[model samples]
Target: MMPRPPAPAARPRRMVSAFTGLDVCETAGLRLAPGAARVLFEQDRWVFAALIDAHRMVLDRELIWEFAEILNPCWRTVAKEILLALLAPQHEAVLECAHAIRSVRSPRTCFRFLQQFTDWFNWLTDQGVTRLDDVTQHMCERYLEERHWSVPVPGEPRRRLEPDTMAEVVRAMQLPVLYGELLSRDGCTEGFAPWEGKSASAVVGLKKGGPNRVPAVPDLVLQPLLATCLYLVNVVGPHVADLLDVVRAEADSGQDLPRVTKERVPAVREVLARLRAAGEPLPALSTDVVGRRVGRYGADPLTHLAWGRLARMAGASVFNEYAREQVLPEVQELAAEVGIERPWARQAALIAQADSGEQVPWTDPVGDEDLQLMANYVVTACLVLTSALSGMRTSELLELSVGCRQSRSVPGGGIRYGLAGRLIKGKRFGGVPDEWVVIEQVDRAVALAERLVRRPQGAPLFGSVGLSDRVKNLRGWLERTGNREHWGLPVIPQGPTSPRMLRRTLALSIAERPGGLLAAKIALKHISVATAEGYAARPGGSQRLFHAEMHAAEEEHHMKLTLQAFRDAQAGIMPAGPGARGLIDALRHVDAQLNEAARTDPKVLTDDRHLESLLRKLAKALHVGPANFCWFRDPSKALCLRLAGTPDATRPLVGLCDSARCPQATHHRSQRPVWIGTITTIDALLDSPRVAKGEKTRLVPERDRALRVVAEIDAAASTAPAGKD
Candidate 1:
């Protein structure tokens, strides 16, 4: 003011431009004059409002500030402050670059920096990092290095990048120092100490000259890994599409992905089945068979062995391991005692060699004494193997019902029941009925199933009849009932049995048996021959014959006896006569006593209390007591003897009544009433010389009538009042 601004310092007239000339005002449709500029500025603020609206769509809202810095360098200080406050240090560099591009007076300088910044931004976006702070310098460096790295060229002596010039151009750009810092933080630095000096090129192993090679995996290990993957995919259940994509990618890229055919699956199954059957630990067959069957596909024994090992490692069963360890040793011992060469001795030795730690083979033989102890186990195993070998599952075994039978229509003869089974393995197959089958083990299983049937239609054949406690205790019972040596059977394996393994072993056995192929297929209810064929190829077929013979006769006898006893009980309770009358009368008397006591002393009349009291009295009286009522009627004498065979038989009967107002009262009148009767016909029958002449005969009806009259009188006296008019 003092200087008067020196005539406004010869001020040049300020240029008046259209608001549209300014990008911000142009975007907002506003004017540039001071008065109108305020309104235009406010209108331009709506752009920020629109950004807020678009926030969700933008992966990184921080990028908007950088964009702002690039568009208006005069706002660089504001943008820098906003970026520093909003983002990490790495992001600040990006914003600075953007600001430099916008602020540069030369158009060429501005264009060059803009191009560099844009390219860097696009790369960060591709890496899923939106903020400059999020994209580490190390990552950017590694990315550029990856792009430039030369790969081995097939049929060429030297290596080269696919696009040779592209890497050089990218490397020439002046990338910010923060790029390297970010990369170092992310552990992407070339020759990083922790990375063992592996540059990006070295890590990827890109070279120029040789054919593209894939790594190889041992077949044994590969099979199990593949099987495990399959199990995880199929049994555990996961995203199939995602898993398949991964597998497909890995396979196409020649990664060590597992490959298995349908044939190989069964072979693997057989190996696992054998290990399970033996109840042994898995062996390392992968090392032995890796290169033997590289391209060929079928049942690979080595693959099977490897799978078994994997299955065990995956916690298949401890009992399985115990079985394997115990079975072979026992078998060798038995073979030596019996002077027979161990047929599977080499197999046993292989197992021993392959065993790590306490793993051993079980080889004890079945004995007669252990038969009952291991009956359920043996029977269940046989049934399961029979089905598995035939290709049947547990569900099918459970679905069997009574009357689900096959009948053979004999030509010009009556239909005979051949075999009976409900839906087996979810399929229907007509065959010989279990009753007709000569195999005792099978018959026992069938009988058990029949016995457990609750409905006429069907019943759950296994684990339906008994309590879990009882089933669990079956192992302990086996231990006590059988010799220790008998616990180890080549087929049965040592240790506790599970329903699952039993079924598997059964399948195996059926597969190995002669004519077992068809029989197993029918038993398992399989739709395809191939499915059943897997079971038939198991190792323990010959053992089944022994099982069948060992159990058939004894189980049949036990079953017969059990049925006979049940029928006898039923028949015995059906007859009506004096015997039935006596039992009914005794029960009625006990009930009356109980009811009276309950009425008098409610607290004292629990079921246990009454039962205990009644049992004690009855036991004392039966063993040693005053003979009171003679319930036993002597048919020869036709006498209902009261106080039978007692010295007081002829004494005057004492009638103690309950009612106080009775007229024929005596000293014992207050006492409760006890019935009075006499053996009137007994005196004459005993005194008669003719009857005593070493002869016995049924009494006449007159004598029976006389006894009946006395009994009726006694009953009346007990119920009616004394000296009734």
Candidate 2:
């Protein structure tokens, strides 16, 4: 029967040779261990483990890629040559590459870049083009135009490639020409340039300053998710910590039992006496374990006893047959006197306030498994809280470790909090050390995460689990535990969620407030000066997302002011200033358009879209000032521009503007309060006996001017048709 198993297969041996072509790893700035093999083609796999950092998100398998794994022989030949050139594009074997890719630091990134072209290589094979020189511009253009590079997946629905994905595909096409010179003689495409040298973005039809598509977490979803997370961290976290403490104590108290002797009876009886002295119930199986026992043994009462708990309490890992047989009746009597409580937890159940204003238990009685689940949920909660408040990228958040919380007292009084971590984006090899200045809540969240998981000083707090999945699981757990309903938390709406989305949400929210654009820039740690300025100069800057949100806020701000002006004019409260006539005329024109539209559809006057469209032009001309609104319809007529001697300036110079004298500026009742306050301040100063002669002269004219403006505002409001004032 044992016809002798076939002789064991021998392990394949790798052939090593003297280094020949080039030290591609050294050229790419990868440090290899001394005395390591440098041969390239002889070995199918090249290990770069020494070059990769432990904290890097890359997998261990990716450190040593197997070039031999590429099934297509022709594709494999070209891929290997292309990878070498990309690693050292400045080498003598490569032609002039003005936009040469900087050295690829991550092997995984390089691997993906080469792998992106497998489908295209197959297309080339089908066209009977075996050599790189045969890949012409026409073939490249056809590949892009027909989307031949995208292969259909088995179960995914067929859809057109996303613009970002397509952009990457176009880059893949250009690589053949970008590194073609470095290829072996037969693999070189000496004269061909992909798509005739046009940029990848241009080829993909991506417009400059196009709308940003990064999804910000919706407020409805974020608000509830954050509320629940905060509750978990502050309210329920202590109880969870207590439960974990019990588990740890039990685990650390090893199960090595003392040798059994006559003293066992006295020890067991003494433990029972102590338990009875205290009002505590006997330790028993959790409800879940009881259910499991009932399921297995047909609901027999004897199957539900927690013998292991009693044995552990009696200075033994488990009870022997002698103690069980002799002491079963006493144990039954003790169980009847004081009911059994769950062995895993001794803390009181947490109370949660329901939406209907009723107090309820946060969860059902928890078993060991349930306690572990709660611990995991608490970790997810901490992650959500940190990400929502810190405005850090996913990679940066994942880079956080135990004891990363940093704090220092400020000069004045309050303490500033920060998290020390490494930045993965735009860094070479191991990420550069960086720190995020955060609020107190974020600092506490990081601390809680550390406490939940017992990691050493530098051990990573969060894993590489998909953040989207974590959020989904968090919401599911909250729902299943009735925490959402009982705690009065809003239902988190369904949507795409990631750390990037959370970061964008914080940026978008901050970008909408006063002086928040600069605050958002600082909060997001956009440290590059060029990146800050590129919003005005370059279309696709690093701050494009922030720029887009800020620009939208600006547009919304102008529209709100213009709409208020229109509503005031409709109520006959005319603006009173040098530019009052011009402002009145503009409002009348917009009102006329609204009335004209309302003739056919009575609801047109009330429809937001209709009103917004009619007022958008007037809104564009409005420039809000500290004490006045500048209707800058004509830059040539702006007094501030004339005084500054900048005829071509698009925006008004608010510092130089004299609103009372400038024909483009207007003052409404809303602005009159500032003038009134100024008048009162000057009056109070003029009335002071310590007033100097020079101060008196300055104060008299200021008070008179303010009084005149106030009178005008008063007259306008009193004469308004609504006349409520």
Candidate 3:
């Protein structure tokens, strides 16, 4: 009988405890051994456990080890220190410098800057510097001169610091210390060194205001400018290189309009030269000269002006009326040509006119009813709204599964929706399923999803219809329905605004709500809380929920009881049956071997022969056919395996005869199984040298046999089905 599969192997039983461990109470809490402490930590304070994990890298080793001996101490202290350092003025520059240094992928290059900063800090301390006041202009100049630092060269081997970086660093370093005082009246602290050779006032002046501000692009100007950029990206398309060459040629030629040519450099250069020259205190080249050049070239005046505007912008002209006018019309024409049918186009036209000295009416906020109507009228509105609300990119939103929900608890106690999304910006908020929105907004969306699952697998939940095509159809429908005029909000003329505004509005609104910017940032899915904090116009009430406040005490108690029940369900450690212990041990051994094999060469463990053998043995144990199994390829093989035989394993495991008729089964049909167990009663017929007496042999009851069969089937099928068949 195949040598009885090497007699299987004897399983080494693990000892389990029934008695409670001694708990030593201290000022903070009772402490237990590492294992018990872990259980306690996970049960009562998972957030603390998660915080410890997150800051494991920065935590002091000795303290961590001590905590590890009993309970994992909160790592919040290290995280707080890191945050404080980041916010400190002197450290802010160092952090920025560190970021810049780290941005260089090459280890050698990154190390150079790291060493430089370390040296700078050490030198400052050595000089007995105390407070921002001690840093001098001479010191700053000397540091720059010594380094011979140059501006960053984009996409090059040699990385250099930006020209403005030093000034920024100096300014950033001038802010007052966040925690430790650098220059006390009595003396400086050993670790706290102040800046040298500069007065407090000078440092204060540097830190008081924000960095040199770029002139704000007027709203009227911004619309036209954005439109122009889009128009250029679209119209020029593949010929952008050629267009750049043409502009460069014009700039070099120093003519009003260089002769149009296949070789476009001279024309481009000539145009750039004229634009730059115009910005300078150059005497006007008489109108006659301009006219002559225009006439000879047969060039359209408006086109030349548009091109000239583009060139001026390139040369960094802060303000130019001519450039503004030229850009708007070109953008408008391009929008029309590209078949971009949106109300924003009309807005763009109006904004352009306003920029060109035309008076316009300011529009009020679009009403909710109007927005709802717009949603019905324009299909794009839904796309935009979904994108905004979900903080997903247009592409990502389009790809979203209908099953997505709003909330979920991660491995840690961290929550993943609402404020988290606001903070992170564009990415999906965790701790929530995607289905949350569908459940909340429109119940039909979920029904539709269920229907679609039967119709088509892996299709986008929102629209299986092609996006651009649907957009076009929706646009036509909106025009026919007359919803456009009905819902259209009269606002300042702007470029092609889409549902993106809704997302921004949502973000801003969330920021304005309780918890203010931080909450909004979390909702928007921003990466940094600080980034989110910046968006709030004013601080709002506390919106963040602590773990203790989340659930009712009764509910928490119920959960603990439920967890204990689950543990009890799986508590029995007896060997299942004859050879069961050996089989389990052998299976475990094989698993370990496979794991090691995977480490060495993943292909080895994946070999068809090894898999087929395992599957065959598994089939024999479960008494199931191999054809019943199917593996999915996309996400994970293990998950695919679990979903395969669900239909066949349901009834017997639940202790119901004909589970279809059982009320409990029906009630819990959709509810996931929490735990599964097999209870077997074994009887020894003979203890001595094999003499089977008639009285010694007891008949096994049909119920017991049936239960055993079901248990065996389940054991073979574990990890092969998510639910019973």
Candidate 4:
């Protein structure tokens, strides 16, 4: 056995000088940044002690930086007085406060602890609390409830302080309970934990998912987004790569040069005008060039970058320069080429497509707007596709390096791509490297983005100027691609686009399907905070949590849906199936489990498991079709299938139904319209001279079935009494 080497001795502590370093500009053994000392001068002895301890013992740069940053804002304002007042009285209380927050070393943690603790101090003073011993469980509960802090947020004008932040504030407020463990016992009373389960913030509900709240991508938005990503990855991507090569060759031969000029003014101004009309704020140009501020709306980076560059070139030696060498012509042609043109009205003519804002791809001339627009849309598409599919958080999404794609063979067979990146949040120095197992669409999105940047290893995959810019670009893309008539609300709605939303949406979908939470764990990196301990990255535990969260969310959603179903039944607006009443009966039976409050809560019903199972069961019996529908999943369970002596595959075979006599074919108000419309279509076919006798024979029974459904609904609607529950 080898002998262990002697452990090195600890370094000597840095001693604070008189008047908190007022005499000397520096302290021996103190490796604190000078800025830290300047801020320390404004704080009291306890704060200085804490800061010095952080510098000498903790030696955490992030902690020191946070202290400096948090204190600096107060040094020049009324915040300074507020800070001084905290340290002026109850020296023992202040020291106890300092010691209590000592373990909180992260800059964000430190800043939050100090700031919130100071706020707590003021609250204590306001409530006539002169010392730590004065605090009670009631006081802590009162503080949590009456904190009354509100912050301004984008889209929302007045957002209240988050429950998580309030939770932290409450934790800091309760530190006095630690007594001897937290601070010296000389000023501490007979110690007791004042806050138990009574703190209001302690029981904060999981709602909005904190500051990272983002709504899932709506199915209306998702369909087009997926379509656009597919087009960009499969079609425009290859074309653009080839075009880039051509432009590169021209530049290499000295036949192409990047140019900016004033003649571009008309095109640039036109694009800018449209952008301004869309209510987006323009980016600033260099050298005192002012952008016309549009009314209240979000910011878009691609449009801003293009416009900022053009604005900078306004009077620069160009546009008005024909004396210059003819350059970048190939690049200009490439930009002029249309990679993708948008959305046609589904049932409208090709000309109406232009009327609906889609430009002609063949004969339509591509302008500067088209060039910039295409580039912006391409970037936006790649970002949306990659972020949504990969389940990477915003920082990870931003930090995504080019050439991040890795392909590996799956156990079964074939290959899958994993998008690799480093997780920066919650990490101190060296970030934890992680990857997401992605579908082929995500792989293509990354590849397309790589082609755009030539896959630079050092640069961000989807570079936006700022968080606002990232959000703006997302909002802009949604607006540009959306169908106005279909999507009634503004495409971006009123909130921010964040990575959490993408991760949540994917987790929710996976959990609801057969895959469940384990599937989510594999898909989402950093999904679980429980793994955040041990400094060993969980890779994607959040996905597991996300799965659990989605189940809760889904259960909540089903509760609402079930309530609506009860309303329909009570109002005599029954659904179009014999199973509808049975489903309602099952819900009532499930509701018997809840106490008096929940039994009649109008929203909540059976336990999550019971409720969710009921909903799925109902869905299986509630099959839908285009023209005629059937409410059955299995032949043995279905009356219509039993009479036919045929087993149902996955759904009811609507053509096999004898609707007039089929016990499973119950009609309601909504289905009556479909039945009526089907009857009209069949009548038109019957009236047609080109109809063959055999075809007419086939149509007769179907016509009779439609007639029967209409008669059935009419009979039900008329005979059924209308009332409220």
lDDT of 1 by residue, 452-519 (tens): 22236543344332222332453344345342223221111223223343333443333232212222
Best by TM-score: 2
On residues 415-463, what C-alpha lDDT tens digit does candidate 2 reach at each position?
A: 7676778777766667777766667767777887887887799888987
Pitting candidate 2 against candidate 3, the one with the higher TM-score is 2
Which residue runs of candidate 2 sit more than 4 Å off their true CA positions? 1-24, 31-42, 49-55, 90-99, 102-105, 122-129, 136-156, 255-308, 318-340, 344-365, 485-488, 514-725
Of candidates 2 and 1, the better by lDDT = 2
Give the residue spans of candidate 3 off by over 4 A.
Answer: 1-119, 122-137, 144-168, 171-420, 424-725
Q: Report RMSD for candidate 1.
A: 36.3
Alpha carbon lDDT at 341, candidate 3: 20
Ranking by TM-score: 2, 4, 3, 1
Q: List the residue pairs that clash in candidate 4.
A: 257-328, 261-319, 262-319, 525-540, 526-540, 527-541, 527-542, 527-543, 528-541, 528-542
Q: Per-residue lDDT of 532-626 in model 4, one digit per residue for the tens?
A: 22123342543334445655655554355455554455566555445445454654664454335555667754455544554555444543333
Best candidate, lDDT: 2
Candidate 2 shows a clash count of 0
lDDT of 3 by residue, 40-67 (tens): 2112211122222111112222122122
Question: What's the residue-level lDDT of 219 in candidate 2?
Answer: 66
Q: Residue 354 CA error for candidate 2 (Å)?
A: 7.1
What is each predicted model's overall lDDT from 0 to 1? 0.32, 0.69, 0.31, 0.48
Which ten residues in a row are the worst by lDDT in model 3? 623-632
Q: How far out, in Å, is residue 569 in model 4?
A: 3.0
Better of 2 and 4 by TM-score: 2
TM-score of each: 0.17, 0.67, 0.19, 0.51
